[model samples]
Each structure stands twice: as C-alpha cells, then as structure tokens.
Target: MFSEWKFTAKEIAEKPDLFLSGHRACAGCAPATVLRLIMKAVRGPTIVTNATGCMEVVSSIYPYTSWAVPWIHTAFENAAANASGIESALKILKKKGKIKHEHVDVIALAGDGGTYDIGIQALSGAVERGHDFLYVLYDNEAYMNTGIQRSGGTPFGASTTTSPAGTVIPGKLQNKKPIADIMVAHEIPYVATASPFYWRDLITKARKGIEVDGPAFLHVFAPCPRGWRSDPAKSIELSRLAVETCIFPLWEAINGEYQLSTPSKVLALAPQKKKPVREYLKLQGRFRHLFTPKFEKLTEEIQRITDERWQRLLRKCGMT
Candidate 1:
C-alpha cells in the first residue's frame, strides 16, 4: 500500500547516525545494517532494550557503545519484559509531568535464539498486556554468538554445529517455526517480515510499528556470513536472492489483515516468476551438501517446503 514513498542512498546516508560505526560485525554484517535502517526511522528520542546476543556483544563493548540513544542491555530472555517495564514507567512519568517525553520510541531487540526460544514467553506477555512498543528480532537462523547452534528459526536441511550434515543425517530435520504467524495469532496491532536488502520497506515498517498504539513485531532477515559460511560481499545480494526465490517473503500482518509488502506484492502475482530455490541455496555453505548429486532427495525436500510456504503466504494475504 505504501509504494509511493521513495528513499535514496544519499538521503539515508545523510540521516542522523543513531548507530555509530567501528563495531565488531563481520565484513558485511547484515544485522548491523538492519539496525541502522531501523534506527533511521525514528530520529527523535528513543529508549532501546537489547537482549544478550551478537548485537549486544558487538555494539556495546565494555567501555563504549555505538548507540546514540538511551539503551539498556538486558538478559537474553527478559528484554521484552524489561522493555515493557520501561514503557510503563515512561507512561506514568509522562502522565505525572515528571518527564518531558513527547516522541520517545521504546524498542526491544533480540536475535533468533532470544526471540524464538528463550524470550518467547516474555514477548507474549508484553504484547498481551498491550504495551506500546516495538519488538524487533534479527533472525540469523542460529545462535551465532556462542556458536553456530541450531535455533527454532533455523530451516530444514541447513547444517549447524548441533545439527551437523553427516553420513547418517542430512542436516536439521525439522522445519522452521512460523513465529510471525504466532505473533499474528496474538491479535496485535501490527506484525511484519522485513529484509535489510529492502531498506525503504524496513524503515517504513519500523516507523509504523513505533507509531502504532499497541505492540508491534518485526522479524528481519539478516544474513550471517560467518554462520552461513557465505561470501562477505554477497550478504545483501543473498538477501535479495532470498526474497526473489520466495524462501523469505516480505509481508505484513496489520490488525489481522494480511498483505504482501512492496517488493513481495509485485512478485506474488506469479509464484513461478520467482527464482528457483537452488539459486538461493548454492550460495550458502550450510546448504552445500544439498547441491551434491547424492543429496538430490534432500534438495527436493527443501524445495517442497519452500513451495508450500510460498503458497501458504499467498493464501494468507488473499493473493490466491
């Protein structure tokens, strides 16, 4: 619906740098880029709660932090809870005229491990209580900080330290959990799936989620070069290929009404128009085993799931 809004590289570059440079992300850190785009959406005062993960470790080293706004480093499982408390306190302070908080945006950030597994309970509670804040999860498909261990967000047939691709087993045996759908089931005001490759959509979604009165969730697709064993320069390219292949769709569920985002809307017209899953799989080392002739069955299995997911999303958005 918001196709007319356009942003240029220069415009985004000139925006106030809420996330400073000189952090410990890899050469092409997609999560850091996603953070930058999200922060650009709201230039005013912001209070951020970050969970223990790659972002918190890299951005806020002991002596310094890249964040220009008021930030809190909470435990891995309670960022959402802490954010809820902070937001509630802000409301009371604003009501009592104790703090001059006009446009302060409260945000909770976590990784896939923190969001899908460790922090799901706190997230559910915060949203159910009708907190006015945005919860964003940068999904890298595994626990990237400690090690490359499989997470609930990990897709099938991808190899992690725990879910290794060996002689007996191919890779992770289970499909990824549909966390976005789970959030939608909560009947929240807004929930969205975004990718760092589409900065405009990411920024717009973050701004809308912040403006909404109720809780909002944004699941961002951020590629991990070290974890995925992919080329550093191809991170953004892989993200785009992921969307064009329908492996990761760009969509939003707003107030229980589902619709594809700008880029996804254009491609949803014809599922056949999207690139094949092989184009997306071959680039990642984690899926390299599936490309071999011996693992044809595994590759086909992954393709089957991809087709099913793409069609399901289409039906959900009423594009079918």
Candidate 2:
C-alpha cells in the first residue's frame, strides 16, 4: 500500500497549509514540524483532538489557533477518548444523513507525558473498543510544557527537573517505556514509529494510519531544543542521528506483525553499519553527565541497552 502512495515536491508545495504559522511553538521545534507533516498527509476532511501539552499550549494560545481543520483541545488524559467519541458521533451523523461526507478522519495528538503516562488508559480503551481513529504521540521524552519534568517516556540517564543528575542519582532510573510495543500489543490495525527527519516515511505512515479501518498509533520522535538542551539547528540532525545509532529504530506493525522501516532495516541486516549511541548522546546536554569519568559506565550502559533493544527489534522483524 505504501508503494502506491506517491507525492512530488511540486504537489506537496501546492497543498494548502492545514497547520498554519503565527502561533508560538519554539524556534526549530520538531513537534511543530511533526504536526505540519502529519497534516500534509491528510487526504480528506478531518477533526483533531489534542491533549494538553507543549503542542497544545503553543499552537492554541488564547483566541488564536494554528489549525485550519476542526480541532479540539482535550485534557491531558482524554485526547484518545475524545477522538473515539468524535468518530462515533460522525458515524451517527452519517447514518442520520446529517453529515454529507462519506468519511471523516479522526486524529488524536499528544506529547509523551500525555500519551506514555497520563493518557495511556484512555488510549488503550479506545483501541480495544476498535475505534476508527489515529492516535499520534509526538514524543519529546519529557513533560516539556510542564517545566521539563521527568516522564515515563524519558530515557535513562537523561537529566530532567525531577530527575536531576547529582551525586546520589544520575537521572531517571527507568528505561523509556516501550509505548510502540504496547500499542502493537493492542493488536491494532496499524502501529508505527516516525521522525520528522524522514519526511517521506513519516508522511507515508501518517497516511496509512489514517486510512486504516480500525485504531492506529504513530509514535513520532520529536526533538525538543529546550527540554533536551540541544541546539535549535540540530533538531533534524539529532533525529537522523537517533535512528543511525539505533536509539530510535523506525518500524511498523500491522495485525501484530512487525517490520523494520527501510533505514533501520539496513542497519539490522548489517549490524556493524549502526553508529555508536554516543554520537546521539553527545549532541544533547541531558546526557552530558554520562560522558564524565565518574559516570562513564552510564554511557556504556545506555549503549548496551540500545543495542539490546535494537537486536530484540530485529528478532521481532525476523531479521535476526
């Protein structure tokens, strides 16, 4: 199906802006770019339900909004629930001949804090109910909108306000929650991981997710300049490095079957081609402490964890 999807630069340039400018996302904000790319993939009428997080706070300030489509700002724990209700209401309206459209896509957007933590229950319930909707989690890894607090999605050794690196502790003690794996466990029609750096892959996944008949989930990595203390200009670079290092392998699942995306597939087939995870860590200030002599082992531990995860993913894809 993805092979059938095609778009050219000119065609993309001609598409109307579904996510407009003039709101207040930070400069070089990858989540904002993620929203734009997702909107670019939309083919028909759509409604968006967004959880309260960085994107919501920045995109919908006061009387203004960046969304050109019908959008609702839901509480932190209810975006997916809201989307499920919207999909059901649309179905009812169509049955009653109150709505003319044959189909209207429902999309739910949330950050890591809202999705991996507060909103997991709602997301799980909606998917289990076989809701016809797409849930996109733009993961910046921390509660960026709430002052960079540590969250379930936060990686180990990443210092945050709550998980500060110090003498006794070296950051979050837990591994990043395997949210994508959890979504795949739901046995949804579609589940994918994406990054803004891979525009084509991201767009294709978004379109596929929206077109699926049942619940779909896309866990998108969105680099945060503020939260990660990385250079604004390096957002895309960080995104690329993340995949190259196997820190965030691009992959998808359909009907509980896993397949690595093209870029990650290459690395999986030739393990030596994968870059060391340190290249990704060195670019971000959150991992600065890991490079110190006192915490040197933490860096090695992070690399080992990344390698283990990548190998496990390869096994799932039947590449190992």
Candidate 3:
C-alpha cells in the first residue's frame, strides 16, 4: 500500500531542516534521529503536539526551546486529542480563507507511556473521528521520561521499575500491547511501523503520512539507552536487532489490508542465523536476573514467541 511513495536520502538532505542541533535529548537518542528525518520531509506549515515525556522535557525546558516550528506540549496523555482539535480548527480556518497555507500537516508525538497506555483512548478518538492528522508513537518500550517505569508497550520479560526482576515474577508479565496493530484496526488511510535504524524508510513514511488524505499512524521503535541500561552508542544497532529478531517487525496496513514491509527474512533459517537473545538481554540491566537458570526459561519462552510470530507473519505474507 505504501509502495507509491518515493524518496532518496540525497533529496531529503536538500529539504529544509525543522529540527536543528543543540537539543537536550540523551546521547544517541533514537527519537531525535526520527525527529530530524520527519522534519526533513515536511514542507509548508506544520504544527506538532508533544506529550509530556523525554521529547517534551528535553526540547522545551523552562528557558530554552529546540523546535523550529510551532509546537505545543500538553499533558502526558492528551497530545493526540490536542492535535485533533488543532486540525479541526485548521480545517475551518482553511475553508473560511483565513489560513493561507497550501500544506499544513498536524502531528502528535508521544512516548510509549502516552501512546500505548494513558493516551490510547484519546488517540483512538482522534483516529476514529477521521481527523486529518498523524499520530507518531515513539516506542521506547517504557516510560523513559519518568525513571523508566514499565508501560503497556514494554516487551515481555524485559525489566522496568514497575515490573522489576523479583523472586516471584520475572520482569514484565505480558508482552507489548501491539499498538501498531490497534492503529491498523482503526482502518486509517495509512498505518506503518518504522525505525530510526532505517532513516530513509522513516522519512519516506512521514512523507506518505503527510500526503495521505486521512488519519495516519507511524509507530517508531526508538531504543532507550539510559532506560534500557544499554550502551548509549548502540541505539540504532539495538533497534536493528529488534527488527531482525522479530521483536519489532516492520509492517503496515492501509485501510485494514495488512502487508509486511520488512519480511522475516532474518528468521527464514533460524538455526543458522539466530543471534543469541542473551546478547541482546545482557546489554540491559532490567534483564540482569535472567542470567540465572530458572529465569533463563523466560528468555527461552520469549525467543520462542518471537520465532513463532515471525513464522506466522511469513505465512501471512505468503513468503513461506
């Protein structure tokens, strides 16, 4: 469904920059990478609504600002609703000939806590209303802004403040909430999953979202180093692993027709190319307890789950 969009990295560079340097995001933050790419693809007027999280705090501190365009930072759970309101007003303003912009795309940017849990209802309302806007969920997999607590988007067996590794329950009890699939179920004009690991693909998706006539949702897999307790420099590397391991498959659905964008080619011959989940787990302090034998079983189960999902997706895509 998204194959119609076309863009090259060189062309993206020629576009005007919306996100400049000297921002306050953590070192090697995936969200910042995605923001730059999104900004590069944007043309004409644009308004951004940011939920209270790392992106808000880091970009719009008390006395400083990092955004070059119009931005509003609302509470942690109402960014989508706020953006919808802005879009509605803009539609009226445009119809009245009060606004003179040929292209003005409104987008809501939120972290996992805001998107997957607290703000899900508001987001659903906005999309279901068929708002002419885009909602970008930057899935760092936890509430990274406020001490890295476990959010609904946290992956299974991953450790977090609320779901820490304990004697009874090892890490998060449930897997991720699969917010992308939920957005797809809304039957929007465009729904895609992308990562900062592939900046070109991310920019392409953003451009497509802007051109789409109706609601568009883009789920971004952003790796959190401080929260995940991993090396700050391995943000993109970890994100790539997430896709390769099937923990975060890149796919999309347009008007409820599902299509796999990046197939589970990495899982085609699992035995030969499988990277030990231990390597990925060991990088984070949350899964520290899983080094033991009993808790190691959880890791085994997670791998099996990921493998199974990849196999299932392959069949769905008719790649089997």
Ranking by TM-score: 2, 1, 3
- State the lDDT of candidate 3 residue by residue for 105-199, as single tens digits: 99889999999999999999999999988788888899988898999999888889889888888989898887887887788889988988867
Per-candidate Cα lDDT values, in order, are: 0.90, 0.93, 0.82
Clashes of each: 0, 0, 0
Best by TM-score: 2
Model 3 error, position 51 (Å):
1.0
lDDT value for model 3: 0.82
Better lDDT candidate (2, 3)? 2
Better of 1 and 3 by TM-score: 1
TM-score: model 2 vs. ground truth? 0.98
Segments of candidate 2 deviating more than 4 angstroms: 1-3
The per-residue C-alpha lDDT of model 2 at residue 32 equals 95
Q: After superposition, how far is residue 22 of candidate 3 from its true place, in Å?
A: 1.4
**lDDT (10s digit) by residue, model 2, range 89-186:** 99999999999999999999999999999999999999999999889999999999989999999999999999999987999999999999999998
lDDT of candidate 1? Answer: 0.90
